[model samples]
Target chain A: MEERQRVRRPGGRAARVGAAVHQAVTDLISERGYGKFTVGDVAARAGVADSSVYRRWGNLEALLTDVALTRLNARSPMPDTGSLAGDLHTYAANVAREITGPEGLALLRLAVALSGNGQQGRRALDDLLAERARHLQSMLDRAGERGERAPDALEVLDHVMAPMYIRVLFGLDPLTPEYVDGLVDRLL
Target chain B: MEERQRVRRPGGRAARVGAAVHQAVTDLISERGYGKFTVGDVAARAGVADSSVYRRWGNLEALLTDVALTRLNARSPMPDTGSLAGDLHTYAANVAREITGPEGLALLRLAVALSGNGQQGRRALDDLLAERARHLQSMLDRAGERGERAPDALEVLDHVMAPMYIRVLFGLDPLTPEYVDGLVDRLL
Candidate 1:
């Protein structure tokens, strides 16, 4: 029936299942924190069979990685506002919202927890980071083509993203719009 | 008996027990990660009585907080090298080593794990950050008193400390001397 659903509706049922499972994962991370819940818990929460989750994601770590990547990437979307400053402002503001949003801390904590577990977890962390880096590099490259002096990808990570993540993780002050913009100004 | 030993040797027996317990906590965090072990586990690993652990720390969270604050503060002494440039270089280099050290990752992971747990965890996290901010502020104050320009304590944190910490948490690149020094240089 599950295979038939995938075949019949393609994006319709499969995407719904995927979204349900991802939401379940995020909710679990928020309530139970990392390493406390399991695939069965997620399956039960999502109202999907355990076998379906395993068949689709293979394991909890993969499901978590998928959730983080899909949600974070979908939330931020790369900005190309025709100027480097505008691009950075939009990009940094998007990140601030994503990290401070209802599901943001859960995903960030999931990434941190996954990174230290073992080989599989390490791979998941690497994939999430690589994807973000690639996304940001494309933006930087566009700036270069437009003859705008853009900082390196790592610089953006260090100056902008790193501060915001650290603040969120440590439960510090809010990532105000001015504060986020200040980071961009300093980098430029 | 513990009281007698404290009276007889002053800091001798008390200090030894504290060190042993803290080492055990670090080792357990390294091996088993956070929230898996308890006061009993720490006591057994340290070769001290559970009562002793409880008496000193009051509970597991308190013990963990003490370990984090004591070790982190000791490892990264605020450098006052008579120049802001010299002070920042030394300070950043010291932090680079502390986070990348053997026991460093465990303590850091513990902090991240604890911050999301509950009220006690939040307090522990706040204590750690406050101590760090206090230490850094002293260094910046010294620089200012010496008739040198100094960035805000938060700026050093945003620029120098945040990047190193985020990198460590995500298992990113090594904090090479050039990279650490560059953070200070840019801040200046």
Candidate 2:
């Protein structure tokens, strides 16, 4: 009886619902693009009550922000290959896979759209950037501790992250292993 | 009589209408964002008949492509200050200003949104990229002629243009003169 009760905990159910809603939001944005769907649509797709989404996220923008932040957090953790160069290469490759993955472009577009969308949206974008920056900083900090002269976080952002993102967004070229390594090499 | 006839020529009126329509489209995109407005809305804002827009551009995506291409062509001509470094610095500064300008973010978001939309949108994005690439190639060619070992156009795009675009799109730090120069210096 106790085992069954633990399995049916309220927190577990809530988490399952949250995952479903996030997935639904991603799928909708991928298929239909941003600003075309409503909270009700998301709820319908996730098979949850509309009020549940509203109670949790407050509004569509908040919900979108949550989805973006959650996805960023869920991406592969920052690498620790014992050398700055190896770590950067692995980190860049992970990012390349995520952004070029099936739902990557949609999330990227969501971030861009949110930034331009007035106050709340801009705040959401800032939060998203802050999270990514935090992860990058930790990696850089580790390099610093190892007595390696690591480039600043901004350098990695400007040189490595920015190019990969722009290329994917524009469909310019494949983010091949050679190309990803080339960015890390240049930055180093 | 001849001057009046020239002023009132049909082609002159058509050009005026095109300008108004383009401005209307840009303004709408800036204010409301992509996919939020319609052809009728654009025509109403531009003070033209709906049929007029349809006859000229055929669809919203085409109209958007035209706006992006036209704006790219209308930017300041490629600078030839007798050196690749000078040319890249000036060019990066110009891009920084344009992308940070009042209408810049909206246009960029439009480009991103269009790229993910479908086949037509992908083609439109390709056209925009090709136009920009042509201008970049000309500047590189000039440097080659001067016996300066110029970096290829892709190098410039990857190092300079990509960083600026990604920065502006995410509302990151301002594209300061120093920052723009740093990208050029690194590329050279």
Best by DockQ: 2
Model no. 1, DockQ: 0.69
State each model's C-alpha RMSD to the native. 3.1, 4.5
Q: lDDT by residue for model 2 over A114-149, one digit each (tens)? A: 887789889988987887799889999999999999
List per-prediction Cα lDDT, in the order shown: 0.87, 0.87
After the best TM-score superposition of candidate 1, give how far the Cα of residue A6 lies from its true spot, in angstroms. Answer: 6.6
What TM-score does chain B of candidate 2 reach?
0.91
Provide fnat values for all models in the order shown.
0.74, 0.77
Residues B40-159, model 2: lDDT tens digits:
999999999999899878988888888877875677478889998899899999888888865887788888887887898889889888878998899999999999999988888888
- The estimated TM-scores of all candidates read 0.89, 0.91
Candidate 2 docking quality: incorrect, acceptable, medium or high = medium
